[model samples]
Target: MASSLTKDSAAPGTPGSEKTFFGHPRGLATLFMTEMWERFSYYGMKALLPLYLVAPGGLHLNAATATAVYSVYVSLVYLLALPGGWFGDRVWGPRKTVAVAGTVIMLGHLTLALPSSGTFFAGLGLVAIGSGLLKANISTMVGHLYDGPDDPRRDGGFTVFYMGINLGAFAAPLVIGTIGETVDWHLGFALAALGMALGLGQFLIGSRNLAPRSTVVPTPLSAAERATTLRKALIWAGVAAVFYTVVGVSGSYTLNWLLVPLTLAGVVIPVMVLARMKRDKELDGTEQSKLSAYIWFFVAAAVFWMIYDQGGSTLSIFAEASAENSVLGWEFPVSWYQSVNPVLIMALAPVFAWFWLALNKRGNEPSTIVKFSSGLVLVGASFFVFLAPLSIAEGGHKAAAMWLVAIYFVQTVGELTLSPVGLSVTTKMAPAKYASQMMGVWFLAVTAGDATTGLLSIAGVDLNKMGIVALEAALAAVAGVAIYMYRNKVKSLMGDVH
Candidate 1:
């Protein structure tokens, strides 16, 4: 549901004599709003998914099953971006990919607007494919609009574009979430579709300002090569469709079965790649040592996300089941709690940015490993907020919303602590030849952690509320402590990375 892939990207669109948006580029405004609505679709559904699964009028799935489904769906969404990046770089180019991908996403949401279990599965697949296609390329296109890395407008432009994403994220639950909770879930999905439609339309109109590079494939295929690739892809697609149809007809297939392989893939793919990089004859001693250090950071990042990203799963469930959703005698949807994190990020993220900058200026900043450890500790400690609610809110009583809000705020700070630095550090620490792949490696940490989250729920579905929160808190705290205890050793492995 979150991404480190595009977090550190440049911004703006084609610059020239064209009038700019917010003093950047007109193309930026287009992409910014397009991304905004696309995210609205994504986060809106995220807010509603678990509740809809368990609703009497909905899928009627149990809590653990629904959460697992959500987690796997999220994990796949990120994983597919790897291929998406390749497609944009080699085949369709970023512009065409974005336009087509946006349409697919809209259609997926429209499919979800229908009321059927079969449509639900198909719709999720479409959305995941579309999201994968759009995820990395759109950001790539944003970078293309700039005049390269030295473009002064790049950072500011990306900052504005980033706001678009968070704006959609912050507003989604407040708008679509309320409708889903009070009106109907299908109707909510339809609105998500409409959001994508609006974004796609705007993008089509405004993409004229996009740079020529938008359509340039970094690796183009010749006619015969293209034909061969398409043929093989179609063959594979046909085989998959047949397999799915046969499995569905047998009534022996569960979504869980797909998850087992996917969960393994999330961790395994990165491990295999990192191991290859470590053993590559092309690298020297320093690069190899950095990889060793990176592996430690990778594990830490996975643990951090495993704990932080639970805001939408078990935490959301806790809010729905045990926390108050009313104020001044006016009841609100529990899904609104999902918005708290983004809004806090919007408000406090700048403060964190300035604070870290000031520390750097004063030469008082903590080392990267220490910052990561701090993030782990803080995020883990946020889990303890649930302790009070679990203690006093016995039986059917709901706890105050402020406790959850506090947890989200602290977690946001923890997020700011590690995530912003994690991306840059990974890039800086990787061997020169492995620069790009290191970005993918950074993302794999997120995917692995997210998949692990679902796997744990599937394995520990019977865990009590108290036990669950306690375990999460303890796991993160212990990881943080362990990482801190060996910080000097990790730093040594990092060599000159700092």
Candidate 2:
């Protein structure tokens, strides 16, 4: 009787269908648990990294140097997504790639749990590679859970999924970063390893419910897919060889190594894809126009990213230097401030989701382009919340913690407005053949942004003073002008697609 009930529950579309629970899948819960823990580990390690470098017995590197290195690390993690996406499209299906990547990430966390310089670098390498694979693919899997393109449940599902991501991110730093500061670094790293293990376990268990990838070649790959994949592999291999020479000769490969090729690809791939589309004669005029619009938005997003991604580099250093913290008669560790944005995200995502839906129903919501532009402006504005306190902190005094918290609260709302919507926009706008590659191109902007952040760190900006305010104001003004000038065109391009 129990076996019969289990089989019924697992079956596709009965009253107890495996595909849904309150307008979502029971499987989503499992993936939620999986992603939550994965984020916990990622954020836990991140929280301690800058602190680890500058602590008394730590690397003893200067602030500028360490932030640059940290930016390089973060940038590499995103830039590698090109190959990771290609690997999913060609060698392994997205699901299998996710599993393999999760295991690799787990190993990376464990590697950092040891106390040796060699282990640190090695672990960083592994984590970067693993993040490349897992980050792109797991999100891809969330879309895979639905059977059709216009599934109503899809948007809600991703919101729930993003909540899980923030849940882990919000909790990990507080728990693991605190432990590292109070107890030991190894224990914090060990916590990361454990978190990843939980994510991997949940992912494995839920694998049975995931829908198969649309691009998975059941028989054998067509000549085109195979040829494209082979070219991609060769391109990746060339990138690796160049990095090998860079590290061998200079003892350090700058973050720019990852950006160079990706930047080129971002330019070239769209042209190549359009050429292919023209040759096939398969795309209609509307489809072609939509693709063109996507390219434009990608360009705008690249500009926005130049400011948005400062969080891990310039903003991080600012927090380390100036943010005030005191709790329970102990000053909170500066790194703990990183938790602020994630915590706000966890609490506010649902509200924003509902708000968008409600506005949509009333025909009163902003268009996608407007929303993106607003996000850019808001991100810029969020930086200024600290301007007063920062200006006053010049003599090594701490700035008020409320300033940072205020910034995060506003910035997280901006994040909700932009991020998931951007993901959905890309998937909707891209042609089926170029979908995965275009997603990779989207990330190239992030790589460029991180590279720019690194360069800014090298410039020695006085982030605790008017510098941050000037930078923020500049971003807001540029974003506002761009959006205002392009308003009609941007709205036309969206063409009721949102």
Candidate 3:
């Protein structure tokens, strides 16, 4: 398959080529499959994590503790991308970093396959590190595949790539979820390891699909810069080791306690990164203004993900404790619900373009920030869809499976509105040297969302689903309205990028 991907004499997207990957590039197929398998690895573990933490034959942690662990684990995965992106550019280059990260993810899944509480946390840590590395670098690599900001195929290409993400996610619960729930959790985790192993092999073979510049150092480190970076890295490593060692020896710190500092880091890091971007001399006034507009988009992305990403946590709990699991005489695992959003993504990816294309023909298409705001509002509305179910459950009736399906449907639409566009917009807005470039800033939005998600999941422990849902929904609505009102200003700030 790798050989076939590169076998075309004219190369993909060339004058004579027909855009071999669904009217795109053949290399897109290789990358598309690579991301697909990687997502299968990711979503496979995700489908199992929440349930395994609390179920029998699992870690058997209490609900609050399990939620804490889930929150921290997911939060740290994106949070670590800040450093992971740095390592990719300044150290190993994006291509090698992705390979290394994929290997770590495989090892992480294998670790989870071991049967012990200790191994569980260890596994999550390793997977988070690898995912952070892979995600930060890989999305930017996708951006590199296109000609530039003005390329018409760029957005569509990313949408295709994004489908690969959901395609893998769609298969996860059906494969890993069914097995994990009906069989051994360890075996399910082992399956995830196998998917990553396959992804690594495919990626290695299809390595040529990557753009030439994508493999080179975009910004090389000078001698003095290298020494300073090394010094900082060593100091941080030593400090982290000693701090964790002291806490470990004392046995006084709980996993929940770690969330405090993590929350702080999530809040601070984005600000610091944005400040670094503003201070960068390479960016012109127009780029800086574009970034200023991006700040609002970032807020929208964070809010949307804070609610949407909870599908694996809060929604999964609903599927377990409240949603009907038996249908037509067949019993299904709660994890089966995990596949809903991804399946919709696969279904909707094609329609998304045509929908916008029709609107563009009418000259009434919404701007990028407007689409982001719409996504935020819609995600919030998805949570609000749970309101009736919560009330119904209070009266002792389980929710119909379709209620969860409805929520997922709405959430998927909202995600499609923003997720793919965000990457392309970030790529267009960012300069080459502003601290991990576009991806770092883009993922910082996710870091902030996931950081707060852990704290928000605490609401689930007390069964305050209605209250939390209402508050979060209302906030998103307000934010969306504000962004819509300010759309013109944001567009102005964006200059010619949009």
Candidate 4:
């Protein structure tokens, strides 16, 4: 296909001759398609995995057992990103790392097509590792498309990128997850492979555009690229040895213990370095000040993520167990409802982007702090939207479908305001040397949130009725208090984005 994206024929600030869709770059569409397909595979499997493991005709495991397995899978997916991000930075570079990650995911899907617990687990491992490598780096690549830390277009670009993610997620559960749950579990896994195949193909064809990696590569004795290449080989070898011994051999028991120290180190080491960097006279004051704000934003991002990340964990299981999806005498599988959040996201992203920009023009825009606060509040409100249906249900009856849709709608708005904008902020606040690592720090928040969700699930709540209600209520209350207490401080920390 001919490239729809072209350089501005006219000078900077001059209106170009060629038109773009939705008033954004055409390359955004290509990336959108690639991401959409990839997410189709991921969310498709994710939506159905819990049900597949516990359903009557499926793995036939108990709810507790299924949930534990689900938690482990989700936790590993995020946790693995630690090494994935580091390897992308120091060794393979983002582009190659992403490509390799895609290949691994494809293999995972293929392995999932087999009918054995061993194959199922093996597939899950591949998907987890692959997701770890691709997730953070691909977002990093989006930032790389912009020229500088302060580029105004960067936020808009990430919004477009986020939409691509939703487009894939929106379709997956509806089309693929449903098929898998109703038809054949293996068929759904095969469909995931096909989705990855499409993404891998699109990326390979578009490789030239995605070149010029910003992730750090170690310089070596010989000034040439070859010496840098050799050093990277050694780093990856060390990483593989670590994963093999810590996670592979020792099992989940050892994995848990090792992750504690590693995660603590990931967060503490970076902030401590920034503190030292501030005292040095060589750095610009604007730059030094931005660094501090970035740390605060990162802290907030981590907290918000704990609430936001439930979609793939407890929320997925919740949708499977409780949400009613019947209309006109037809029944829909519960997992299919997982599509709602992304669907709402696809519809709302442009509106939120323009809404913020419109407010900015009027000089009444929310600061990044204000936006983050708004996100926190909106997400809390979303959980409460389900309280009514949840309370009304009696016996074995499910909650009304409208409740789930309402929850997703509110959550989508929260995501639109906070998620991509947070990415832009991370890129803007950090200096170049720390750019990729700061992104890792932002994701570490997500990892923390996922881990928290698992802990909450294991809290021995009443799985049938009252337990879910308590969980949602607790989440809402905590989020509201956090936002209220930090509002002024966040606004102050945002400095002058206005």
Number of the top-ranking candidate, with lDDT as the measure? 1
Candidate 3 wrong stretches, greater than 4 Å: 1-26, 140-159, 208-215, 222-224, 279-285, 431-436, 457-464
Better lDDT candidate (1, 2): 1
Candidate 1 whole-model C-alpha lDDT, 0 to 1: 0.83
Which prediction has more favorable lDDT, 2 or 3? 3
- Identify the candidate with maximal TM-score: 1
Clashing pairs in 2: none
Give the distance in Å from residue 25's predicted Cα in candidate 1 to where it truly belongs. Answer: 2.2
TM per prediction: 0.92, 0.82, 0.90, 0.78
RMSD of 3: 3.2
The sequence of per-residue lDDT tens digits that candidate 2 reaches over residues 1-498 is 111213223336522254454456566666677789989999888888877766665665666666656766676777788777766766777777788888998899889888886678678878889889888777777777775668777878787888788889888888988997678887888899898998898888766656645236323557897898789979988988986797869967664464344444444554565466546567667667777677666655655565665565556667766666765457876667778888777778768878988998999998777787777777777776656666767766877777777777777877787776677788778766665666776776666566555655556644434775667557764775687578788667656586
lDDT (tens digit, per residue) of candidate 4 on 306-396? 6666555555566666666776668887776788787777677668868878988999887666677677667767666656656756555
lDDT of 3 by residue, 66-168 (tens): 6656767787887788778888778788888889999999999999999777777788889999998898777767777777868787878787888789889
Off by over 4 Å in 4: 1-30, 142-160, 208-300, 431-433, 459-468, 471-475, 492-498
Residue 59 of model 3: what lDDT? 78
Q: Which parts of model 1 are misplaced by more than 4 Å?
A: 1-16, 222-251, 393-396
Candidate 3 lDDT trough over 10 residues, lowest sum: 7-16
lDDT of 1 by residue, 1-498 (tens): 111112222242354324666667667878888999999998998898888887888898878877777777788887788888878878999999999899999999999999887789789878988998998899888888778889888888788888899999999999999999899999999999999998898889877878788988988888998899899999988987898799889998887667677777776876787888888998988988888988988888888887777788777777777888677678889889889988987898789878878999999988898889898998889888777777656665788888888889889989988898798799889899987557667877888888888787677563227777788788888888898999999989999888
Report how far off residue 113 is in candidate 2 (Å). Answer: 2.5
Shift in Å, residue 197, candidate 2: 1.5
Quote the lDDT for 66 in model 2. Answer: 65
